[model samples]
Target: MIFDEFDPKEDKIFRLIDNEGQVLNASLMPDLDDEIIVKAYKEMLFARVADEMAVSYQRQGRMYTYPPNMGQEAIAVAAGLVIRHEDWLVPVFRELGTWLAKGVSLKEIFLYYMGNEAGSNFKNAHHVLPFSIPIASQVQHAVGIGYSIKLKKIDEVAFTFVGDGGTSEGDFSEALNFAGVWQVPVVFTIQNNQYAISVPVRSQTKSINLAIKSYAFGIPGIKVDGNDFFAMFLAYKEALEYARAGNGSVLIEALTYRKGSHTTSDDPTKYRDKGEETEWAKADPIIRLKKYMDHKGIWKEDETALIEQYRTEVDKQFEEAEHFTPYQLEDVFQHTYVDMPDDLRRQKLEYEQFLTWKENRK
Candidate 1:
């Protein structure tokens, strides 16, 4: 197995394709058909397009603050390809590509960011948790789901994602500890995108790498070249199979670069230098995947036209979300409790009176 060969303790990163799309580890290359590879590339491209458009909408005040899943596309896309429909996806906000793959509509995503609670109700996306905002909290949820699946004797694996910095949170360790004890089928992915907001990976831990954390939990771990699509795919394929075979959870530290600002409200220039950004840009996931396809003589379609088509589709989704019904005042408090407390009811009434008075004045 790849995990047996590339131990996280040794700080060895499993890589199939290099930055220029040259296959470095031919033996580790996944046995994906050429058509599937092309489809994967297109999915990655569509994700990038949608991500860029979301950022643009945020800038224009059409949508609220949004996270950009720019350079980290391959990690999510690979997992999406490997994940079964029966599997559970517990995401921590940034896995846009996987969200798309799991049947989350762009409109639903936009609605959530627009501060509407209805967006959290992903009716079409089966076995997927809502986008988690708090760091590492979803890791615990994923473990809980894994435990339940084990009890039910179901053939389901729980896949959870967190940032490199999230590994420092108490919940991160707690979840892994129990998951190890129970031997639940869970795949914990750490998207080590170099920074958690402004803090770099070096500041997160003194350990050689994030994947080594799996050692404490007695789970197999591997460090992967997150920008290489094939590498990420192969890692997920192996991890999923191992977990499905009743071995326990696996930890994957996807070494990638956050090519954009942490969110629409934050500034990347303040913490990351241009030289470092330029260096990472060369290893951009989309570029590497496209290069690989081009080399394989499969990427001969009209690229510009395809991108334009994606942009239009993304815009249509955003428009639908923009024109969706406005968030109701009752939605804020009504879902909090089965029976609204007297104080909460009073507060809601007060807000209603205030709105009425303001409307009359207008």
Candidate 2:
């Protein structure tokens, strides 16, 4: 169950539940009660519905550009299920599920995609940081937060989510090295979805696995089945526990697939193979858990229907969220600093003047 104990060629990949939800290895399974399982299931269900709604909203011009985490629910939910609320979560763009799992409200997420400033206003509820879209930029923030936590003698750990493509960035490597050298309590999670835009994983790096890169930094690395909830949960739990126990940092590579377009603006059909999509779809995280639940007699058809009903309610919330006014053009300068400087003031004025002139020309 530990990183060093794992073999890269044989035991690097762990699976407690298969794609069909069959319990493949019960030994590694985490102790979970019915209530927790049901809660996890609900979170996954809501995440799927929310992701779909956001995609739909974007297609209809109700929201701004958004990323889709269609087939990666288990990665978020499992991590969410294990991490403490006091622990800080730094996420990349494709982490809607993690946010929700960390107790972020559905309304707030929808509002964020809808371009409302109020959506990013969950300052007091959770330690969830704002979503970052600039590849591996958030990794540094997570490292800084973890360092601060250590300095303050807080029992807090930082979990940062990045993609396989983000690993190519210099910031990713620097963050891992900094955390490893400083022995900061941080976990760097790389969700290897196989593609960074049109670039495939094969071209991303020649390493057999992303986890193996951790060896250079003197930190433990793990590669797990991202679709298998139990595997992800156990792996994350182990890493988080290690960090909390003052074991420095760990790198986790969750081997998952995108299973859909990169985002609402992307078109996978252009570069990806159709067969690969179908193959990954068969390993759907929700279906895998449902199969296991059914086998254990814990899942019922009627209960699934209720879950769907709840999803419908989530959709309704998105609809209601859309009614709120979008962020004003000037509001963009507000969050960057406490007060606008002379340079920003002049830029804002120029932007306002451009808008005014356009309107007059019309």
Candidate 3:
């Protein structure tokens, strides 16, 4: 009966570590070795560094606009830890941590955000889709991939991430419907970070919680502390296993907060409470994990060394990405098709002539 209260409709929030770095539920903790835990902590720090530098890059006009996942490091790190090498990841734009965990390089992310089409190309990467910007669209894609895995009788599970607002989109609902009907091996994960581009979860729906949406599709729905790494790891691990076992699909709603703007294009202070910022700050995911690591005597030099290592890596990668040639007009035409259509080829030529004429006038 320890986890008997974990039904999705209920408002019970599953948390392993409290805000003060205390374990609230030891019984529900996942089985992980010390090295794995340490690695998880390191990856969390790496992701945090990348998130901070990306925002600074945008402000400096060196990078394009992007969503920053500042307070949700635990959720992202846990996702990387939970899934096996064979499982698939369909991430939205905010999941840099997930990408890093799955072997995506910071240089590649920088290349993509710098407006180069080559960043979307993952020639050797396995099972991970390109980062999607459209909301709720990746859900069905994940289900579709899972359906293929099921058909091939391969042991694989696909995981897709969406936001609170994405749940309202018809595509998300359709994904759940399809997953339930066909019993595909997919996990629909929702990062209900309390806001969807300034819209609160309360404003989105009156459902008991986002996880409950899973029940309508006849699958189990789970809710977990998105800020607690242990809780998230356990939830995702179980969900992946359940789906891989050919049971029904699973939905996990990670409850956390978006500590920064939805993206460089929007502002959060226009609608969010200043007081709530203070409260979520106390529940900071990185701080919680750091405190827990220190208490366990696993944090060397208070993790200063680890931070410096990643800081150095990030800085070097950003510099390399910056040195890459800027976007070219021909790049745009080449990205759309292998063999350009006649109209597109003609337009490219016209644009080239216009540029040539302007230069001649100068």
Q: Higher lDDT: candidate 1 or 2?
A: 1
RMSD of each: 0.9, 2.0, 1.9
Best by lDDT: 1
Ordered by TM-score, highest first, the candidates read 1, 3, 2
Cα error of candidate 1 at position 89, Å? 0.5
Model 3 residue runs over 4 Å out of place are 1-5, 325-328
Candidate 1 residue pairs in clash (backbone atoms < 3 Å): none
For 155-246, candidate 3 gives per-residue lDDT tens digits of 98998899999999999999999999999999888999999898899999999998888889988888888999998888888888788789
Q: Residue-wise lDDT of candidate 1 within 230-274, one digit each (tens)?
A: 989989999999999999999999999999989999998988899
- Writing each residue's lDDT as its tens digit, candidate 2 over 1-362 gives 45766644343686788877888777767899877787777778778877886787889997888888888998999988888989999999777777876777777877888778788777454798888879899999999999999898889999999999999999999999999899999989999988998899899998888988888888888888888888888888999899999989998889898877898789999999888889988889888888888888876547668767977888777877877675688787766888889889898999999999999998
Q: For candidate 1, what is the TM-score?
A: 0.98
Deviation from native of the Cα of residue 43 in model 3, angstroms: 0.8
